[model samples]
Target: MSRAEVKQLIGVKDVARIVLGWGAFAALLILHPLLEPPVPAPVLVIALAVIVAVILVCAFGVVTQAEALAHRLGDPYGSLVLTLSIVLIEVILISAVMLGPGEHATIARDSVMAVAMIILNLVIGLALLLGGMRHRGMAHNRTGTSAYLSMLVVLVALAFGLPALIGVDGSYATAQEIPIIILTLVLYAFFLFRQMGAQAGDFTEVDTRSPQRSPREERTGIRQVLAAHRAEVIVRLALLVVTVIPIVLLSHDMAALLDDGLGRLGAPVALAGVLIAGIVFLPESITAVRAALGGEVQRVVNLCHGALVSTVGLTIPAVLVIGIATGQTVVLAESPANLLMLGVTLLLSVTTFAAKRVTAMHGAAHLVTFAIYVVVLFS
Candidate 1:
């Protein structure tokens, strides 16, 4: 390959990310014995920090490539790729935590709840606040946003609330688990079909009064752009997979270290869930904020709302299957307090998206709810 081809395939920063990600994974494999229990406090702390930093780097790399793919695919499909990639990371982390050496029956529940609170309340709150302050009120597609929320309400209720109401000891029976898993997957599949098919237009920004470009023109533009960058798409997709593999392989080590470190420090168990959610969503959170600030309110909505939907939709079934297969108890129900918080968050989300334009006040309301979630988490 020519130098320019090599350069396009992997930039200097991409090289750094690949090296750090895979290098960390290789080092962890070689040094696995040292990470065992009774290690020195300093060593444990250093290991945790290094693993987290590497994971973050790999995560950012994944986001960069996913964004490139999203730009190529356009709107709902592009957003789907981005959200699914992040959600894939989330599933890996959650699975690592659950399968790691611990009685973490509730890790899945805690993580899913954390993702919802973080994305719906915290991330969206900040995006709306910043975007609204600059633009007075940010406009988004009410139809698409509403569809996302409608699915979220049912899925959240089924995954979190209904389990508490019906399951014995905060978990479903084997029979119940199979049906619920199928239901969640089927619902999400149907939603994806509509979002990408007949209702695809609902996900994009459209100014009916003063149109910028016709649908045909927009389609032509996307095609031309995709054609121009076909080679880049292939390169980025390859890199995205390369970058993600390290994070997946390294996650088990990270999980072991995190469990040990947090146990030593006597931190709240839920804090692990929060950290996982934060790590998994950090890149997407930043992207959403930038999109909001750039006046792409619908893009912000797609990123934030779409992420949580994907999180709950995909993570629950995954953990449940793992639990069934491994004989681990996976908890899906939330505590009374968390359930109440989840209810409030869902209701608040409906209200926020019901409007044609979102303002700072809407953002403030969501932030207040998120603040309460944090307080509840620590207390």
Candidate 2:
């Protein structure tokens, strides 16, 4: 075939592509059990490698569609959807893994810590590094960055520290945890309504990292698009939900397999924490790299930071509610690696904000930090 034909073939698609992509992945996960000890080591390795690659490709599609939907709706709340999607995946995996009979206090702790490192190193790291490199000297609404940082500090402290302080004293069954959970949800709701809703104008935080547009009165283009394409929107929404279910189920099983695999390989339990982090972050990592390359740094910031916030703000409440309702308590306690990662993340976040520009060097630094996280996490 001609080069053009090959390119066309590469882009070729219909429901069949989606089905094959999703179905093959689903089948691998289902049949993973059948690929037993009898299978040759080399063959099993190749098969597992192929499965991971396929899953990564599917993740790309999932993230791309999510980005498309967000663009169609415009950002802010649209970004919320993308962030929540990932957070839901994390919560599902974490909850599912924890459901198995072991002390998952470390799982909760490490998952949150893993997320913190991803946000600080990968997300904020790229943002500052690339934005600084491109702009050399960029400026943002310091107030905005500071405010976000402050909220982040409080949120992290509460989410991670509170469990140790409060302890699962069975008050989880009483009204005690209720008030705390309610307060947590209320704070998130306030920010959602204030920033993305009617009060958005009151907070003018320009992301110096991104390109600027005309300060004209905002238009309702997005609203019109969403209204006109209601049916398509509904279809996409339904597809998102449909896609999520299998991923969640597969992730749950994947976590289990990962645990067994780690034991077989003599891997640290922290490896499982890292895997949970990887599964949840697979989508955001793709989007972040793309946004940075596309020169949409502000969007990148919004996505990365916004995702961090949502993971803590949104996922915390949902998981807490689940735990409360199901008579399980999901608190933050675990391996020392969790605290180590958290400290690193917090320090990086503060440095990024204080010095509002990022360079390729900075990006490189963040990547190095990420490497450290991987080493420590795996060690």
Candidate 3:
């Protein structure tokens, strides 16, 4: 009955809701692969429904974690982690599927393009647009934004555009691609280290003016916080790993089934791309949507812009190397529709950010652009 007890009850209730939601989602995800049609047909439908539910739940968990993790790890890499996690999942799935010898090099190209187009058109575009609408020109350090965007352009151009323009013949041994791949990866690694380690401040909007604390001060502070919290960071990370592994397995199964199902159903092939994007982007998409609803444009800007940069700059290069090495070729060469989509995405992003600020009108404009993309894909 006491006030402290009352507050504790409310806190526990909120935590319960989150845990239950995620737990239910995890359950469905776990059950998805086990629900093969050797079982009754009606039962299979029920299982698919559960799979859908789990996807929604997992999406919720992703967005919730994004806010919390971003606070802890700092933007934009904190946000980068969300998108990166999804991209990593996709790469793992594609790599697994492409383990065979007959896989096309263009598989890598198509996937990269698919992911890029989805991220650019829907995830990044609308997040920024809606966030801009809410904030009416949310402020991000223009310098950092420009740098991130520029690097993204160059990386995508090199990875996707170059391959297309050159019309690389299958006759060229993948061994020839290895050196270029290594050089690109090494360059990326160098930039990553510099960005995260010594120059982390260069990417931030917040200016931390406090003098550097001693190692002891930092350690003591960390110790106190860890001591105060019952759950450790390691525990959360382990849970994330545990939860992620099953989801990844289930995602692979679902990807194969969905591909078959959509093809049999006479669904547009782009639906396959959309489904892939849905699984990979569930986390980032939910965050942007929630931020839009909440009228938090700055968070939206950080999520969308950061996701775009990470998808193209990091994901594309990583996959290019993986595809070449694994002989899967998940790059952008498979689908011309995907190439057109990527071009539209790049054009929209360049124009959207060219002003260095965004408005609600811009958000509406981007939504219209996204509508066109969907129409074109389905048509």
Best-performing candidate as measured by TM-score: 1
Best by lDDT: 1
Query: Higher-lDDT candidate among 1 and 3?
Result: 1
* Ranking of all candidate structures by their TM-score, best first: 1, 2, 3
lDDT of 3 at 321: 67
Model 3 lDDT tens row, 1-379: 4567545433443344356555755665676566553545466556556656655655555455556656665554555566566656666666655665565545555556555666566665566566666667754455555656666676666666666665364222365456656656676666666555554444555333656444354445545655654243333333343344444444445554566566666777766766666566666777866766565544555566556555555555555566666655444543465556666666766676667566666666666766676777677
Over 195-251, each residue of candidate 1 has an lDDT whose tens digit, in order, gives 766677778864668755545665666578668876776677778778877775665
Q: TM-score for all predictions?
A: 0.87, 0.78, 0.74
Once fitted onto the true fold, the runs of candidate 3 whose alpha carbons sit more than 4 angstroms away are 1-45, 100-104, 169-176, 205-231, 292-302, 312-331, 334-337
Superposed Cα deviation of residue 51, candidate 1 (Å): 3.4
Better lDDT candidate (1, 2): 1
Best first by lDDT, ranked:
1, 2, 3
Candidate 1 to truth, TM: 0.87
